[model samples]
Target: MKFSLYVVAVPLALLGTVVPASASFAAGPAGADGGAGGTAPPVLRLTDGPADKAAVAVTRPSPDGSVATVPVGDARLTARGPSGGLVLAPARSPAGNGPGDLAQVHAGDVVAGPTTQDTPHGVLVKVAAVHANGDGSIAVDTVPATLADALGDAEVDATVPLTPGDLKAKPLTSGGKVTAGAGPQGRGVRLNVDVPVPDGVEPTEGHASALSASLDLSPEFLFSYERAHWYGVQPSRARIGMAADYQYGVKVHAKSSASYATGHKPLRIPAAEVNVDKTVWLGPVPIVLSLKVDYFYDVSADGTIAVDAEEHTDGRLEIGARYDAGEGWSALSGPEPVSTATPALITGSATAKGGVGSHAQVGLYGSVGVAADAEPYLKATATAQNTPQGASASWGLYAGLKVNGSFFARLDIFGTRVLDKDWELPPLRYEHKLAGSDV
Candidate 1:
């Protein structure tokens, strides 16, 4: 079944309140007017502590008449902008995550704090601040939740604000919910599991199924004729192969397409590898378990780690499982020391990548391996006109990018690398061939 694997972005609004200066303090009756039997008013006194801060200008007089005049002091204060006259106040100091570091905490709409609040849907995270001590140690503190929810989950994780090398954090929650169990080493289960389904189908309590299939064709036309030696040695040969495979399964299946080269020229044809898996439900509702297994030709020690996105009929997204084994690493190509006892390397990926509205696909299937200390070869002759008789073994990876239905192209870069010994092959030992279009 297809599923969404990308992060969803949403819009946010700003909300805040400010108090006006006139409402800050109210002065008592200027005359202290006691209605009946008025006594003498208490003498008013003024005290000046320091200069008024340079930035703080008294825009309006205090109603309580208790304003103390002070010279400009350096104390910071919040002020509203001139246009709208919005009031600003001193914001509370943010708490620290650990020693000398700031902590991230929030104080609103919390779902999984003091109570196991069941939220409609949201992301949750664990946070801590760690300070690295000089003695190769660290100090950690839990992140405060005072920060806005949006900032907390996305930016900061469950990490402490300790020294750079002093802190470690474990994932605590995601999707607006606290993760089950404890730290990273703790064993816990996902709150929900994904089940595969076909396009345009919504998942229900019962079992869901999905299927995918593709057709491929490759043709190699070659013409060759050899000279007849008068010494009674006439060499002529030709060969061609084309095969196709098909499969259907719950999660994945296996299928392939292959073609051989005509004559002695090596046939660089395509191959097939398919897989499907599904989740089986006991009753009509809620899936209990899921099983997924794929088929692909592994030609190298490092498996395929390639990823590409595709949209399924059911409005879900799928990604191709391809691998990039760093430099000097090739997928669908086995290791250099190819031998019977040596390990077998395999690489392949499956996904209808790129393009839109289906019909377009980018799949992977091929073999890449190594034979140590051995020059593996098969000999043959060429017949007819223009055919060449030569033995060739290609070792490299192929990447295909297709668009629409009929417009497709792929580039295969093949070369041999000796893994067992570097200087084994002489400079002239290597061979190069460009077989496809524009080559």
Candidate 2:
């Protein structure tokens, strides 16, 4: 396994010309013109190839010919070119390239199936090159010329055989990867979606019910357009898209600063930077309030603002501050912006009772701003649970009252100050199709 982290930032001023070059750079053309754009190459990978004793074998070798096979450990793969794409040439093909360079491993030395299998007239050989996925996974590029001719009507029982796929050359796209050859553009309608607001702005009642109050600064939506013929056959070209989605804990965008609609120039931002600073109050109470800011633009476009906040936990990490990391989160009590977290992602609430003075909780904080001492006594508690993919967590007894208010508004003053005390609940329903699909 290889770990790589990098920050890439390109000003929109010169992005117009660099955008198209990014695609061409993968074609492996020699020269400064083919030098990659803002994208970074993958790190070199070294995996233990299979043993020679378990090496090549011809599934059905051609009756007459026999190709040589090298010992697994003897003939290993090594980086040879600046590009990360995989090659089938010898190790020192380029002689002396540094790390993250082009790599090569021969088919004959394959620890996989036999390098040359028996065929009717000649042997079926594993030659030529291939590309790998972002994670160094094999992607068959072309089938060997001899092997293709020997197979005739038969096929190689592989996920991606060179026989059926286009045998044309492909430009290496990444380390161990390439841009598969395909035809030109086909005529079809294209739908592009990009909401300027980092967090989508929901329409208010009539004009607006909940106005998103903030100096919105994130291009937080997706922009993809697929052009398929509405009448005849669908186009075979790959859909062109740019995903400036959220990362770490910040929302990334895709807007040319000068213009929201037209000047939507291209900008490539690699890794986001995080800055965190905290202030601890250790007087009669021991509590720490931290401030964190995510720098999207060069400077601090926003800061964490803490208000009268008090939190208590048995064992956890909690802070009160307004963070402007694109996910518009307001401070606990301080208000810099309204809630901008997306809708379907999360919905949580908690209620505890049994004579402990009942406590109901609701929060969409963290990304919000800071925590203030609240003039006097202050207490805090922090809790965090990282749920892995496909995991499920359920809470709530399906009974209780949920309300929020400041210290000034007494809870007793307002009834359950509960409405209808009825156990009946209305139908909970919502319908939203993936926006990418056309109406």
Candidate 3:
């Protein structure tokens, strides 16, 4: 399939204007001026009250296509309307007021939600709906507003299709018979092959058979997200996270059959193989990453008979990022193992009882600040006397991450393996086998 990867980075400085650390709610528009033809809006005054053990408010959409405010505890006031359509201003406590003063919400004001400290002495106001009077007075509406109301919602999903321009394929052997065709369902490219075999093929020592194909893929972009947050006195933190997943390698699909005359020698055939090398950019970032993929499939048979073997294998790499505020940069996460390789299947029957076997393997290697390696492999064998005998195979996929330079946070998911003086994660493995079968 065709797809593009996009990397996004957001800085905290552009989030929004900072407010007073002491005041949870920021100041609203100035009060209106009282003039000849101007009327003043109703005033909603709030006063500090005795601390209540339970005080909470929730803002949600109402069935009537309006927003609704629900409050619980000491004072319960419900308002309905669109959220954040109102405004709120800080309340001033009267002279000689103490910490235990009783909290009061006037007719024009409503408690949007509970405060972080859960104290009425310094009530936090989340204005839902309030009108601005010409005289600068804050007027209350039927709807309440809170921080949740002001933010709305944030969520997304995206996808990109694959095309032929994204893939390049070639034959491995000179003069090897190879043809490119449509992939399954017309989504990807499929390579077909038919190589020439030499006459008077010797026994197990030698026979003539050569056919293989390889492919290189354009860089693929995946997904990304950026966010900036400003905490009162704390340093503003700019966070950006992104991920990419792509596949490359040889022998993605191999199916073969061969026949030989009577002989005691067995023949081994390198059915298919490929190698790839490419450099890629980490979307929108200046960092450079390189990757390599290699694949090989082989089949062998001893005796005068016919043999059939087939193998389907693929490889994928997943890349992720983490921001290092201390270093003012982002580091990549270690690669993880994925189960996408199919088991190798080999079936054969010989006139003279002999043995047949096959092996397939794919290795994925990558380099960023550090080096990483992962391999998925399979093997199978079977024997036939005078009757027909078939054999199925099983395989395993594993990865190893080695640090060559500076140290970064370790991704615990990948097991650990120590090589030289560097620490590496043990490769992940996926296995599947047919019953009563040996590799």
Candidate 4:
């Protein structure tokens, strides 16, 4: 069946909401100038360049109202101006590929062109004004819809006025609508139009669509792993804040949240501390560093963190640094002590007591591992070094609790460990008490 289609720009009303409509490229007699018969072919002229000033004398005109030959020069033109600028958009190529010579120019876009340029090939008019829709999008109106509808056949020609009698129609055969399962390509089945083709006519237009379903997922486990391993995920922070340390480790942001740090023991409870260490390679070898922070319910959770807008929650602020050795000490030595394998980080560190500290016994840290019973958690063991004579080294135990939090943990307290010994070793500080160098 010859189902002809036409392409026309739909006027968008700035006084109301707008809905995007799809249009087909108007088709017509085989090999016609406009694809649509009895219409002048579209002309291409640079609206912003010297070529726009070139005039065409219509050297030759074809029977189809197409220019067989035309003049091409910058001097053979007249300089005319439109009231406002033009919005020029990149035109898609004929093959639907990419940018082409053709441009989509809206009436009121302030196009980049000097007012002194003009062409005598076609008629041009001055646009009264231009306006914005407030958004980054532009809205241009060439002719009022009311006036154009009233002018009818005079405003535009190819679109013939359809009389009431043109509404008569009869079913040629029958078409079927899909009432059941999805089609082969994961979409709803399509309905087939069974109308027969006319004797010398060909179908010039058609549309096919099928329903589709899509699923998006965010797995907790995967996000957890990615956050733990990837440092410097956001480079902008490093470029702005820590340009020097930026080379050592990319700046990383760490946040933990909960509806409420509640119950006898909520895993991420108020000021409950957790230590997670990973081994990364800046070059060929590995640099093992640990992130230990005791969080306080700090900033109110931003709505971006969750799907439900009304479910406002709270989050913890992290006060920690990406690590490099204090001053001495080998780069890595892994998560555990290389010489002792004691599962402790005996490294020089900088404490916020405001300066650098040497040989700080930070604490015992852990990696993500499941217990023998498949209980997923990080295993921890707190240890102390009592280097003074006759003192005893004490140790404690803790696990990086994920769901079940530290019940009694405070700002400085970690997990559920009770401070039994005075292991208050000063980030475990000591200045090598250098045997006899005047204490």
RMSD of each: 31.0, 28.5, 23.0, 33.4
Q: How many backbone clashes does candidate 1 have?
A: 97
lDDT (C-alpha, whole model) for all candidates: 0.17, 0.18, 0.26, 0.17
lDDT of 4 at 134: 44
Instruction: Give the winner by lDDT.
Output: 3
lDDT of 4 by residue, 377-427 (tens): 111122234565754433221211111111111211111122332212111
Q: Residue 410: error of model 2 in Å? A: 68
Model 2 lDDT per residue over 1-439, tens place: 0000001121212111111200111111223231224111111111122223112222221222212222112221222233322222222222221111223434332212221122111112343455654643333333433221111111011011111121222222221211121111111011111212322222222332111111111111011111112211211111110111111111211111121111221112111111111111110010111122111111011111111111210110111212122232222221111111221111122211110010111111111111111110111111223586654433211111111111111111111111222212121111122111121
Instruction: Give the Cα error of residue 231 in candidate 2, in Å.
Output: 34
TM-score of 3: 0.28
lDDT per residue, candidate 1, 123-198, as tens digits? 1212233344453222333322211111110110110011111111233322111122211122111111122222
Single out the weakest 10-residue window by summed lDDT for candidate 4.
Answer: 239-248
Which residue segments of model 3 deviate by more than 4 Å?
1-163, 166-219, 223-308, 313-376, 381-425, 435-439
Rank order (by TM-score, best first): 3, 2, 1, 4
Q: Model 3, range 280-302, lDDT digits (tens) per residue?
A: 11110111112222222222334
